[model samples]
Target: MAEEDTARHRARMQRKKAVIEERIARASLERGVFLLHTGSGKGKSSAAFGVLARALGHGMNAVVVQFVKSRSDTGEEAFFRRHPAVRWYVMGEGFTWETQDPARDAAAARAAWETARAALTDPGVALVILDELTYAFKYHWLDLEEALAVFRARPFHQHLIVTGRAAPAALVEAADTVTEMGLVKHAFQAGVKAMPGIEW
Candidate 1:
């Protein structure tokens, strides 16, 4: 009975491998992708940063425009900014609750969007990461239509990664790959404080 079960498992694995290979052969599309990471999860920005690291590994020129984070002391920021190929901009005054002024937030978002626009249009930039950009759109700090237009007009070979929760429907529709990170549990809920390297 054990031998029979092993044979069956081997056959199942072979079938799965064949199916995967067929799909790989069928997929021939190759171009820069627009990726959106959304939903109520902690890894949205972290996942985007992983892609940034991959792009840099390939010697690609990249730009990161942070929309709603004021601090520049994060580990990823410090490390990526040291690379000559990256142009990093942290444009937000702070989080919404901390700023406590809608007008001020709007102005900051606008400024960040301007920088993002330039990055998107630059043909030399291979990758662009707009970190925490959903908050700007969710709060109506930036014009959605204007942002979409800029995205549509971006260079064909320029890849974009937009990360944050509550991504807009239009943005989702525009993205070639959309990943929604669902949260099942969190350390914060367990009263665990965020540690430096892990949280940052």
Candidate 2:
């Protein structure tokens, strides 16, 4: 009976391999992708940073523009800053609640977009992380269509990542891959304060 089970598993593995190989073969075009990480869960920005780390391992150049995050003391920023290939910009004054000034937030976002726009047009930049960029559109700081046009016109092999809560529907429709992280539970809800390195 063990041998029979082993034979069945082998057959199933072979079938799966064949299917995967066929899909790989069919995907002939190679270009950079636009990824949207949205929803209420944590890790959206963390996931983008993880991808940036993976790309940096390949010796690729990248630019990171932080929109609603004004902190310069985050762990990822500190580590990635050491990498020569990364150009990081913290362009926010803080979260809306902290700033309490829409005009100030808009100005900050516009400045960040200017930095991001330059990177988007640069062929040398292989990856661009626009962290918390969705807030620009959410708060009417930037026009979505204008931003979409820039995304469409970006370098052919440039990968772009946008992370924030409540991503716009238009942005989701345009992204090559969209991952909405649903909140199951969070430590903060259980009275645990945001921890350094882990939560930051």
User: What CA RMSD would you report for each candidate?
Assistant: 1.4, 0.9
lDDT by residue (tens digit), candidate 2, 1-200: 69999999999999999999999999999899999999999899999999998999998999999999999999999999999999999999998999999999999999999999999999999999999999999999999999999999999999999999999999999999999999999999999999998987
Per-residue lDDT of 1-200 in model 1, one digit per residue for the tens? Answer: 69999999999999999999999999998777899999997899899999999999999999999999999999999999999999999999898899999999999999999999999999999999999999989999888888888888889889999999999999999999999999999998999999888889
- The model with the greatest lDDT is 2
After superposition, the stretches of candidate 2 with alpha carbons farther than 4 Å from their true spots are none
Instruction: Give per-model TM-scores.
Output: 0.95, 0.97
Steric clashes per prediction: 0, 0
lDDT of each: 0.93, 0.96
Give lDDT: candidate 2, residue 103. 94
Best by TM-score: 2
Predict model 2's lDDT versus the native.
0.96
